[model samples]
Target chain A: MSAHAHGTQHFDETKRANIKFSAEALTTIENLMKRYPEGKSKSALLPVLHVAQAESEGWLSAEVMDYVAELMGIQSIEVFEVASFYSMYNLRPIGKCQLEVCRTSSCWARGAEDVVDYISKKLNIKEGETTTDGMFTLKTVECLGSCGSAPMLQCGAEYHENLTEAKIDALIDRYRSEGTRKNYTDLNYTNSK
Target chain B: MSRKLLLTHDNVPNLHTIDVYRSKGGYASVEKALKKMTPEEIVEEVKKSGLRGRGGAGFPTGMKWSFLAKPEGVPRYLVCNADESEPGTFKDRYLMERNPHLLIEGMITSSFALGANTSYIYIRGEYFYVSRILETAIAEAYAKGWLGKNILGTGYNLDLYVQVGAGAYICGEETALLESLEGKRGNPRIKPPFPAIAGLYGCPTVVNNVETIAAVVPIVNDGGDEYAKIGIGRSTGTKLISASGNINKPGVYEIEMGVPVEEFIFSDQYCGGIANGKRMKACVPGGSSVPILPDYLVCKTATGEDRLMTYESLSDGGFATGSMLGSGGFIVYDEHQCVVRNTWNFSRFYHHESCGQCSPCREGTGWMERVLHRLEKGMGNMNDIDLLVELAKKIEGNTICPLGDAAAWPVAAAIKHFRHEFEYHVLYPEKVKDSKHGHKEPIMPVKPAPVMA
Candidate 1:
């Protein structure tokens, strides 16, 4: 019932039939569910919702939330409450590259506001607005645990840190040229290890 | 240049891999805990170490573990509170990202001590990269006999799982974290049924910070008494301080407890003094949640006693002239930084992060943000300052969780320490509106216009 007038929450019934996890993703979800006890597969809802968001573009459609609820054996309201509570989950549509810059104390002290302003000027879009080409959506987020490397932003799974105006320019150019929808699943799990 | 207990080999190569970690005596504590010592003895050793929780509250770790309720046929759970979303705190992420196997080994030892067969690392969602690092370490742990099933022919079976929370700052609260781990909205549960008694599917649960669990490694390796000998007074063992903001070296440093606050800030080996050769104006020696202290108060107490980083020393004057060593998130602010704007930024963060479960926190945080915004933007009268004080007092002890307190402290501290800055914004409205006052330097120097084609 909590609605933001950015995007339609309802999706076509036909789209719901097609929306699902890939074989490998399903295996990952099953393994995740196994981490809990019997009849506690619902505990995997948050992580699984991330997977569903990755699969169905960058944001969570109502159909995707319902599907996640079904997959985890929880109610639709449960999924909606969770999806809305978290800042990471975008209920509406977003650009190909969602630039979530940290605007908290540590990052702010180190010039996060300047970085936000720089990105806005470069993209000609205000914070939380997608570019006309649907290439970038600039958003200011809270601390992302990369405070040491302050004035940072996250695009897909990449954390661009120690940001300068020139670095922001270069990053914008790179993401713009990539020209593909960068899903949350675009993360490189191997690189982090 | 200080003693490094937990981060002993922070600079070692291939430390992330289990093979490299094991080569350097990684699972020795697990061996010591499981094969050598009994569960009670392990608990006794932690109590002897005098180790306190590193995740902000500074609770006694050994006493916390001893409080776990054990009903027959009911399993106990150990959850590592990796949801390190505190604004200026990133020490846990650094530990888990660079030296992850240490945390896993620590988890195994802790799980054994608590008789817990299942454990979880509930990390913040934004640290997706660090989560994978932890997962890889966990898989490597399982591949060996360190985790899962009986270990070294001992009748102890343990399963460790990593649960990633979708971004909620309130989830850092233990009860809220349990709700999040149960895949629910992270609203802090009212106490009386604490997590130790009834938590996580109504089972006995022990939630500790990643640093707290990882510190158990050293406490088990070296006898608790030996570990206790390193630091002064009750603040035993070395601690990880995540230094950021206007400090020259903004990273995680593992320092022996009882280090002098001034030395930690100005010394060459530590933060290396204020950034850009600027004078120190103010600081939140802990994370953003703690009271902000000006230069003189931060270095020494009102009684002129040298302030040390210990819990007792840092809070010598009790909020009137003291702050906390909370979570060891040392944030420095140069004289150029504006207190009004910084307070406004913190207000916005709290407002955005409020879970909206309690009306005081939900509505009060928003009201504080709006008032601070007007004050910062030079549109407020002087009475707004008194209004902020009143609202902060009302919200402090009235909420279900510490978040209301967290939100209230910065505002209260800013007003307590830097009322002149707010007055400056109000008095010189036009001047303060265009050019931010208090800070002598610009945030980011405007780069020259790009060469026109």
Candidate 2:
């Protein structure tokens, strides 16, 4: 019996009823699980979580984590510990477009702060805050290995590199009009440089 | 103007396609490896080639392969470490993005040599597009009979898949990569029974960097002796340098091991000199983990000998005035950039990335970050410098992984080379508070050592 503030740890049966994967997503998870040897289907947990995140509302809720564990036939804490460890698995809700700007050494050396400031001003949101309309969330992440093209950010699978004010403006307007939740599982994603 | 073993056909149209890659003799290594040569012979060739691990450790690739234990029906594995999250390094992504099939071809040939029936390419999660690109290529490889079930009719059954990590820089370490792949927390395991003996569900496994696996293609096609003859001394073959930060041409470059550092920095073929026409201040020749070298030591060693890109020449001064060619992440800094600030930024990164398994790295990196932040913000006394140096020394060899050493080296090197800058921030707080980027170079006092009080 954990408190409600410890949302990821507490398992609510009503919330569990809401967890459902699409037919396509279920197939993807099953195929991923089959990729490993027998009884080691737990190895598919990371990839399955990716699929679960994409198929859901773009974050891992308590129910979603439990469903993933149950779906993989493991303990709920197994999924909870892993989701908490990695940077990509968003435990709470995020805006549709997650702008992960690189603020590490190379990117910082080449004006990554300016890029972050510009986006925060344009979206009228501070770093780690979401816009009122729920279209954008600004985050400053460490290096995404796009050092050659410094001052870059990742939205879903799209890599917006070589950031300028004009480029960021165009990116904001583009995502604003598209109005769809962007995610890492977007297979058709492209580098919008 | 260097020999391009990996990216020779980079500009070729449709190079990403299987037909074009095969037309250029792509799968020739697999054919030679599985169909003709014995597994032991292939290992011997790689040992003769003298290629070191391109992922920063500089361990001999062939020696590593030779160490794989083969005890009675235990399935061996070859996992390609595509977790390329090194701050100034992105060559693995570039190689995989540009020529996906080359890595696949390398995987097949290497897997055959190691007798691994199933293998995986563990790439970073943020590179979802690159994962898609690799998945497409792997699918193509399997379709063309280069990956699964008796590849090239050599009775070699193999299965290859691309596994993406969520986002963890620590996963780039081989054991941690295995841990993540096994669907667990990526805390790196202690060594005694190394990965070669006990890895990937208690089976023998050989983990290699993507570039290391891809280089196997050229090594098998041409004889290892021929590959060994390409570069200078023990640092054999061409290496991909991921050049970034304050440089005009900041991209990946494949250079012969003997290339002079001066030419590589100034030549139009490489970095094309410092950006904004600014005077060079410093450079981290390897990734952020290695020691940072000042301008004077970058092009030439402390002994007045010209610095070459080889492992030996880059590390000639032994961490006193020298650094390693680690991961080939050539990050340059100009005069306007502050060493103390950059050191702070890097310490912040290591603090954020330390897996927190070991106490010294966990606590030491946090202390170093806070002290560097105070020193950078012009809010500290001079004693903070000595404290940082002491903390780094305590943390250097105290962790389970090299990440502790990685976190320690940059802070120690920055203080060793730029103590005057830290003192300037303390002595002239008003001058530094507004302009942390770099408020003019500091003029040292007649007395070099700081007053303890």
Candidate 3:
């Protein structure tokens, strides 16, 4: 659905420094680095990328990756390799809303295809296609551990499970009305225990 | 009512909070463990309880804990494998989502028992919401002096942190999880010093599943022998089953290990039978990795014994007519579901998730996916079925991790259980090309078990 840097980008020092993360985000990154033993700040790379992606645009550009590598005291290639390895880190810019529907065995058998088709048609887009307005990006991911509540789609930090056409319609309408980029680090999607 | 050790307080409102959890006898185990019991005594109790690892491996937890090499002045680690990305498996997610404190309390008690001062719950990045819930609970634990230096004044200090993974299923593997934890790719490590000797940060570590860690709370509270007395032989204690697919009531169920498979699937108390009055065609008793069982063999073993949900009973007949109790991910397939398409879906998942460290898994999974895709699309020759079997055999134990075997088992078992379905697809392609492609009746061979290639 989204494009990734194919491991050919060079880390420019000036570009890395120009890529600014929010002051709060930098503080959070520094705090995360403290979780590991001294000289082991590399352990904070994944979490820092999460906060970085949220603080910057929805995706991690090469400059952003370089920035992360510089901050974590590791090579830029290290950040690139780790970031590309995970599906959650969007390397390229994505739509405001990324609807990752689970398409593995349990979700598939329980009608995930129908959910995808419904969302695609509702948004006038196909699988892996962002809408013309760049309001939504549709993706078919493996599983998000909601097998029991299958036919589920994950947007940002929220899981919308047991989908129907009406629910998809309502969800899309709500997102369009809200016109906000849903992010994983957004505290509003908190599902209280 | 079935006994639920971990989720006994699941329906209790605000059970996720430390106050409610502790009010309901939550941190008592931490108190008992830190103040009264020694680390060796806890390990001995777990060994006596017959608690097996619930993260699909089913290794004895006590034996695993005892295997930790406690050398002089070495910092051993306890990492809770919360990377619950297995298909049809969400028990760990459900456990953490509803009852965060139970797992936190378990982590504290377990870290004390494991003699580790620092522990981490390496949750998948997808569950950021759940991680936030856990972090809040951990903060509460810290505020109340349950964590940090000198916990409970018993001189056993444990700092529990929740580290989120980026999105990789291979990270669920212990070594791969360790590598990811160290800010590297999620490729699995080659075994034989294993994790007990050399794991996280290249130190001796004990990596356990979320359920395995949470079970430690009850083991400490009620004694492992008492916990052992609840379920059948070997499969002691209750297991959390993440039931989904073509079922009337698809949700998480904590069942005693000795419950009959029929009752659990058909009875109103559990899955409540096939959805929309459809007949059950097949079932994956454990997670997607374990072999699938045809309807005929789902309720009873080949020996006509009532199939129970215990580890020993569910896998009574080996892979021929049985499946392992893998992560307790129970997926039921109705008569309307197509086996060939399901096999292809699973193959594609493996192909996507394989970390490419092992060539056999990385290449073999893609090959199987392509073949299964061709077969599912009704474009396969008769030889393609056997070719699929051949590919599965080649990939089955050839990888650095079980992801290859996990990818192989469903393909082999799909053909093993439903060869006729594949043939039907080949012989009559037009019948399945339309939108109304449902396997009306299944032809399951019960006489002779097909020998694995």
Backbone clash pairs for candidate 2 read: none
Q: On residues A23-59, what C-alpha lDDT tens digit does candidate 3 reach at each position?
A: 7777788778878877878987888889888876578
Candidate 3 local lDDT, B104-155, one digit each (tens): 8888887887889988899999999899989888888888898898988877
Single out the weakest 10-residue window by summed lDDT for candidate 2 chain B. B442-451
Compute the lDDT of residue A160 as modeled in candidate 1: 92
lDDT of 1 by residue, B304-393 (tens): 899998999988899877999999988888877888889989999999999999999999999999999998889999999999999999
- What candidate 3 gets wrong by more than 4 Å, as runs, is A1-17, A187-193, B439-453
lDDT of 2 by residue, A25-125 (tens): 87788788888878888988888888888976678988999899888999999999999899999887778899999999999889898898898888788
Largest lDDT belongs to which candidate? 2
Clashes of each: 2, 0, 0
Worst 10 residues of 1 chain A by lDDT: A184-193
- TM-scores, all models, native as reference: 0.95, 0.96, 0.96
What C-alpha lDDT do the candidate models reach, one value each? 0.87, 0.88, 0.87
**C-alpha-based local distance difference test score of model 3:** 0.87
Question: Candidate 2, residues B1-453: lDDT per residue as tens digits?
Answer: 799999899899888889999999889999999988999999999999998999999999999999999999899999999999888999999999989999999998899899999999999999988998888888777778887787778789999988889999999999999999999888999996899999999899999999999999999999899999988889999999999999999999999899999999999999999998888889999999999988888899987899999999999999888999999999998887888888999999999998899999999999999999988889989899999999999999999998999999999988877778788878887777754446265332121344467
Task: Look at candidate 1 and give me any clashing residue pairs.
Answer: B336-B439, B336-B440
| DockQ class, candidate 1 | medium
